[model samples]
Target: MNIVYWALVFFGTFFFMEFMAWFTHKYIMHGFLWHLHRDHHNKDHDSWFERNDAFFIFYAIVSIVCFYLWSYEDVWFCLPIGLGILAYGIAYFVVHDIFIHQRFKMFRNANNWYARGIRRAHKIHHKHLGKEDGENFGMLIVPFKYFQK
Candidate 1:
């Protein structure tokens, strides 16, 4: 409720959502759901929003459920958690898909370390298949171990 409380809630929810995303991406997306995710790995020179974007439909359902739970419990604090998840998804779409993959030319002129690093990490992830593709699983936040190479 207060400004400080809201700030804490926002930051806490952001990190928690990031961790949850990392876990889901590392396991669920790469594991059983690989059937659907495999389309992402296959190289196809086409549109910016590829078949892999379908994963966002599942994410939207999860976001709706989270918001519903937060509303039902009158836990306004958790609303920020839902927002954090949405924010992370948007960031991933923009950074990973659009910028790194050159899905869109919006950032073509922008040269920066963050963009370069993300592009490099994602390239490594796409270089191999199966367990060898484990590197750079995190979208926005790169784990230190992924860069050891």
Candidate 2:
């Protein structure tokens, strides 16, 4: 039963990050913190990075804290939680940065229906360069309409 509980915690945290990402992207990033996120929508700078990348640092800290709690504080569940968050972070980076945005130039050939939908939804989200009137704020889970064939 320990393994089952571990899996539950890991997968549960992974899925929950989607909702958390969506919520933060919609309310926080697109809300009062637009100064940090606006560069993502409208790239007025020529650097390889944006202020938006700071958001990833926040989650990285959370995951690292969870790992610390698991190791030093002896919180067993924290291990799975940290791993789940780490996994989700990696997935978000791969899909959003590499595949959709072509940041690293890989996964360019992943043009399946689901991949197309992800790109389409992201394109729509990027269409609005402002904080207001933005849609499709989630990463892994986008609207089903985008998946239409």
Steric clashes per prediction: 0, 0
Best by lDDT: 2
Write model 1 residue lDDT over 48-121, tens digit each, in one string: 55566777887777777778878897777667767766777788778777787766777876656666666678
lDDT of 2: 0.94
What TM-score would each prediction reach against the true structure?
Answer: 0.78, 0.98
Give the runs in model 1 whose Cα sits over 4 Å from its true position: 43-49, 69-73, 130-132, 143-149
lDDT of 1: 0.71
lDDT of 2 at 60: 100
lDDT of 2 at 52: 95
lDDT of 2 by residue, 63-134 (tens): 999999999999999999999999999999999998988889898888789999999999999999988998
- Output the worst ten-in-a-row residue range by lDDT, candidate 1: 140-149
Q: Which regions of candidate 2 deviate over 4 angstroms?
A: none
Roughly what TM-score does model 1 have, to 2 decimal places?
0.78
Residue-level error in angstroms, candidate 2, position 75? 0.4
